[model samples]
Target: MKYNNPVIKGFHPDPSVCKVGEDFYLVTSSFEYFPGIPIFHSRDLVNWEQIGHVLTRESQLPLKRVHSYTTSQGIYAPTIRHHDGRFYVIAMNVSNHKTFYVWSDQPNGPWSEPIIVEGLAGFDPSLFFDKDGKVYLTAGAFPGFGPEGIIQAELDIESGQLITESKFIWKGTGGSSPEGPHLYKINDWYYLLVAEGGTEYGHMVTVARSKNPYGPFESNPHNPILSNRSTKLPIQATGHADIVQACDGSWWSVFLGFRPVKSTKVHHLGRETNLAPVEWSEDNWPIIGNNGRAEIQHNGKSLPLGEPIPWQGKEEFDDESLTSVWNFYRNPQKGSWSLTIKQGSLTLYGQSSTLNDYESPAFVGRRQQHFNCEISTLMEFSPKEEGEEAGLTVFMNENHHYEVAKTMKQGKSIILFRRCVGSLWKVENETEYDESIVVFTIKATETDFTFSYTKTNGELEVIGSGETSLLSTQVAGGFTGLYFGLYATGNGKVSTSPAHFEYFHYLPGDE
Candidate 1:
C-alpha cells in the first residue's frame, strides 16, 4: 500500500506520537489558538481523525492577553505519551513562561487539570518512560547565545517535580536552532533525536545516542537522518519528528513539513504532519526515507486502509455547543459568544473594534486546510454604532488578515473589504447595501483570494481580490497557518447588538 505524505494537513505543526495497543495517538502545536494541542487518533498510521483538544478549558490552558505580544508566542511544542494505562501531554506556554502536564485515562475525555512542572526551563518538552518504571523529561535549553542544546532531568510523574539536577546533553549536529528533542530507549542504548537548523528551509532532524540516560552522548556519523533542505521537493522544512512502533512491529515517524506549490516558495497552509517509513540499519541506527528525504508517496506493509472521519465542512451552527473544529482566537471570554442564545444561529457579541489589536475579539474559526477552497457565512448584523462590524475574515495573525465585513457608515449598511498587513490598513473596496442580512464569501486559490457577497438582490457580487501569498508565513512572519471564519468587533466600543451567523460552509477543492 502507498500512503500520501502529510497525513494531517494545515497548520498542525510539531507533531508528537505514541502508540498503545492497536491505536496510535498524535498531537500538534496550536500557538495562540484557544483549545490548543489538537489530539488525533489512528488505527493505521496513514488515516488520522481529530478526536479532541488536549487543552480544552481556560484552567487547563490559559491564553490571557497572549495576543498582546505576538501570534507566535503561545504554546510551543507538545509531546503526548501513553504510560501506565494513562495518557500524558506536556507542553510549554511561552507567553506565560509555564511548563505543565495534563493526563487522562483516555485520549478524548475529561483531561486532568494542568500540573505545573516547577524548575523546568526551556521549550519543546518531551517525556521518555524507561523500562524500570522511571520517567525522564528532556528539552532544548538556551543558557546563552550559542547553540541551544538538549537537557535532561528525572521527573516524578506523580508529583510533577524534578527529582534530579538538569544536565545539558548533546548540542545536535551543529545546526542552527537545535530544538524539539525526544528520547527513546532501544535495545540497550538511549537514542536522542533533535530538530536543528531552525524550522525553515534549513530544518533537519539529527540524532545522538548513549548507553547511559545521562552521559557522554555520541552524534550520529551519518547525521541529519531526515531532511529535505536545499532539495526541489514540494515538501520543505522537514523536521520536529516523533517516532512510534506499530502493533505489527514496524517503525514509522510523523514530522512537521510544509507543501509549497510547485515552482513556488509560498505556503500559506503552514507546517503539517507528514509520515515516512523508518528503516533500521545493521548498526541499529534508524534511516528515515531514501537518502534522508521524505516522499509524497510511501509504499510498504502498513495497517489496512480505513474510511476517513469527516471534518470541517458546512457548519450550520445548530448544535448546542461549538464543534471541535471551531477554535477561538485566544482564550475566549466567558459568555462572549453563544449558540443557544439564538437558536440555529451563533451570536457573537462584538468586543474589539479592529482585528490588528492585541485583544481577543468575538471570533471562531477553523484552519484553512487547502489552498483552493470556498468559505462563506450568512451573517445578520445591525450595527447601531459606527465601528461595529461583523462578517468573514481570513486571518493569519493580529497584524495580518483580510476581512469582508458589514459595517455602518454614514447611517447606512455597507459591505467593506479590509486588508491589514503589518501596520497598514487598506479598505480596498466597499459598497452601500441596504440589506441587513448578507452572505459573505471568499474564494481562495493557491495564489489569490476573491471576496464576494450576496445582498438583498440575491446575486453574488465580487468585492475585492488579494494575493494569497500575503498570508504566507514568509510574508506574514508567523508560525501559524491561515484561519477562515466568522468575526465581529466594535473597534473598541461595546457593540449594542450581537452578530448572528446562520451557517458557515467550507468546501475544499475535491469536495
Candidate 2:
C-alpha cells in the first residue's frame, strides 16, 4: 500500500507510539489546549483515529490562567508505552514546570488522575520497561540533574517514585538542545533515541546504543538517522520520531514535521505527524527512509486500509456535551461555557479577558488542518456593556490573531474586524448591523485571509483582508497550528450576557 507522508495532519506533534497486540496506539503533545495529550489508535500505521484524551478533568490537569510568553510553552513532549496489561503516558507542562504520568486499562479511556512524579526534573520524559520487569525513566537535564545531559533512573510505576539516584546518559551527537528521549531494548543491545537541533529547521533524530540499560553508549556512525534540514523537499524541520515494529516484523517510524508555504519559510499549520519506513542493516543499526530523509509518500504492505471518515463541514451543537473535535485554550473555568442551557447551540458566557490577554477567554476551537479553508459561524449576542464582544476568531496565540465580532458602538450594534500582531492592535474595518443574529465568515488561503459577514436577507459583505504570513510560526513564533472558533470577551470588565453560537461550518478548499 502507498501512504502519504503526513498520515496524521495538523498540529499533532511529538508522536509517541507503542504496540499492544495487533493494535497500535499513539499520543501527541497538545500544548495549551484543554483535555491534554490526544490519544489515537490505528490498525495500520497509516490510518489513525483520535480515541480520546489522557487529561479529561480539571483535577487531573489544571491549566486555568496558564500564561506563556511563548506559545510553545505548555505541553512539551509526551511518550506513550504499554507495559504489562496497562497503557501509560508520561509528559511535562513547561509553563507549570511539572512532570506527571497517567495510566488506563483501555486506549480510549477514563485515565487515572495524574501521578505527579516529583523530583523528576526537565522536559521530554520517557519510560522504559526492561525484560526483567524493572522500569526506568529517562529525561533531559535540568538544574536538579547537575550539568546539562540526558539522565536516567529506576522508577516504581505504581508510586511514581524514583527507587534509585538519577544518572547521566548520552549527551547527544553535538546538537543544540538534546531532548525527546526514548529507550528501546532490541536483540542484544539497548537503543536510546533522542531528538536534537531545537525542534526548528535544524531538527534531527540521533541514536546510540549500549549493552546495558544504563551505561556509556556509542553513537551511530550515521549520527542523524533522519532529517530534511538540508533539503527543500516542501517538508522541513523533520525530527522527534518514535519507532515501532509491525506484526509482520517490519519497522516503521512516526515523527513530527511541517510543510511550509511555497517560496516562503512560514508554516501556520504547525508541526504535524508524518510516517516513514525503517530498515535495519546487518550491523543492527536502523536506517530511515530511502536516503535518510522523510518522503511525502511511502510504499509498503500495510495493515488493511480502513474507510476514511469525513470530519469536516457543519457542526451543530445539539448533543449534551461538546464533541471530541472541540478544544479550549488551556483549561476552561468551571461553568464558563455550556451546551445544555441552550437547545441546539453553544452558549459561551462573557469573560473579562480578551483574546489578546494571556488569560483564557471564553473560547472553544478546532484546528485549521488545511491551508485553504472557509469557516463561518452563526452567532447571537447582545452585549450589555461597552467592552463586551462576541464573534468568530482565527487565533494563533495571544500575540497574534484576527477577529470579526459583534460589538456595541455608540449604543448601536455593529460588526468589527480587529487584527493583532505582536503588540500592535488595529480595528481595520467595521460596519453597522442592527440584527441580534449574524453570520461571520473567514476565507483563508495560503497567502492571505479575508473576513466577511452577512445578514438574514443580505449578501456576504467583505469586512477586510490581512496577510496570512503575519500568523505563521515564523512571525508569531509558536509550536502550535492555527485554530478557528467562537470567542466571547468583555475586555477587562465582566458582562452579564452570553454569546450563543447556533452552528459552525467549515469547508476545506481543493487548493
Q: Rate the local accuracy (lDDT) of all candidates.
A: 0.87, 0.87
Q: Candidate 2: global Cα-lDDT? A: 0.87
Q: After superposing candidate 1, which stretches have Cα over 4 Å from the reference?
A: 66-69, 143-147
Which parts of model 2 have CA positions greater than 4 angstroms off? 65-69, 143-145
CA-only RMSD, every prediction: 1.5, 1.5
Error of 2 at 120 (Å): 1.9
TM-score of each: 0.97, 0.97
* lDDT (tens digit, per residue) of candidate 2 on 276-349: 88988789998777657998987866656676655647889999977777899977866679997889999998
Pairs of residues at least 3 apart in sequence or in different chains that clash in candidate 2: none
Per-residue CA lDDT of candidate 1, range 1-511, in tens? 7878789989999999999989999999998888888999999988898888999998887776533545686788999999989999999987688999999998997899988888876678999999998899999986573347988899999999999978888877889887899999988999999999999999999988999998688988998899999899878999999998987788888999999865688889999999998989888888887768998888757667677667669889889988778899878866679998889999998885457766677889999988789998898888888888888999999888999999988788899998988788899999888777899889988888999999767899999988888888998997999999688888887687799999999999851
